[model samples]
Target: MAVRSYFLDCASLRDYLQGIWHEVAYDGLNSVVAGALVQLAFGVVKQTESDVFADFPGQVSYETLERIITRGNTQKAEKEFSAARHALVPDDQSQESDEAFVDLKEYMLSDAYRNLVDFIVDYQKNRNGFPTMKMLMHTTPWDPGFDLQQATKEERLEWRRVYTINWLYVTW
Candidate 1:
């Protein structure tokens, strides 16, 4: 019997977010912010795929299996992201040390990130289901645990970088 297939491609997810970003204008939101949020969402989905499909056998394709098995690559990407995120702030002062010294870039990025998540939730709620691959390449349900509200400047920056890497990997 032929195996049933369902997969989410990074390139497709990036494109979908790009489209939404273009059409919708959330306060203080832009393409870069949208891209970063999309990356976080992608990571959340990818990280949870195992549990999401635990009950189903042979549902995940070989390509997905290969991607999942390369845990080292994912970890490396995340570490690179973390470094880039930390580099956004001053070395002399930590982000937590000075709430007054608000990094406008980080603030804007975080707000946009939260707004995007709310948008997705609303979209799903209205549709009464998760989007299909054709509608949006999201494979797993949107995880509420992926919150960036209290995330430090470095963490937010890391999420952006991760998305950027995913975008490049998918496009090229």
Candidate 2:
């Protein structure tokens, strides 16, 4: 199935991610994968041939990006993500940490994340609905670098970089 279909049918964000990876990795003969790979290859070659390429620092090659998206180094990504999680919410504390990424399962099952997902699903079904203050507050824990509890209600409402989800699956 296509990525969009995966999104539509997915029971959770983790499921969606797995479905997307499966589409990219498991079926090289699939037209979607074949066409997308060809297009990306062409774009990479064209960009490489351009004069301004030298201006772009840390430029990633097509092969690198392809490996990242299609077949990530799962063991390494898991280890890195685990270490980050441990650093953020250390063994002694229950307080939320300022980490930007977490294990997919941890993120999906979090109260804040689940609330956001519910809001999105509701919005999709209703087509018109603004999340209440409670819904917004539910996401405060996941806001990186922002301690909502430290701020007053009015200030907390202005929280930036609020993410429904942020995860890293590394290839290298």
For residues 1-172, what per-residue lDDT tens digits would candidate 2 score against the true structure? 2221322232243454456557768755475765665566556445543423344347634333323423455344444442222233556565644555434333323334443556566456545454445454544455567777788754543343244422210110
What RMSD, rounded to one decimal, does every model reach? 15.8, 19.5
Question: What C-alpha lDDT do the candidate models reach, one value each?
Answer: 0.46, 0.43
Show model 1 residue runs off by greater than 4 Å.
Answer: 1-20, 23-28, 62-171
Compared with the true structure, model 2 gives a TM-score of 0.21
TM-score of candidate 1 relative to the true fold: 0.24
**Runs with alpha carbons beyond 4 Å of true place in candidate 2:** 1-116, 124-126, 140-143, 146-162, 165-172
Worst 10 residues of 2 by lDDT: 163-172
Per-residue CA lDDT of model 1 for 54-137, tens digit only, reads 744676644444344333354443332222233236557544332233332232243445435544554565464433343343
TM-score versus the correct structure, for each prediction: 0.24, 0.21
Considering only N, C-alpha and C atoms within 3 Å, which residue pairs clash in candidate 2?
none
The per-prediction tally of clashing pairs is 0, 0
Q: What is the lDDT of residue 20 in candidate 2?
A: 56
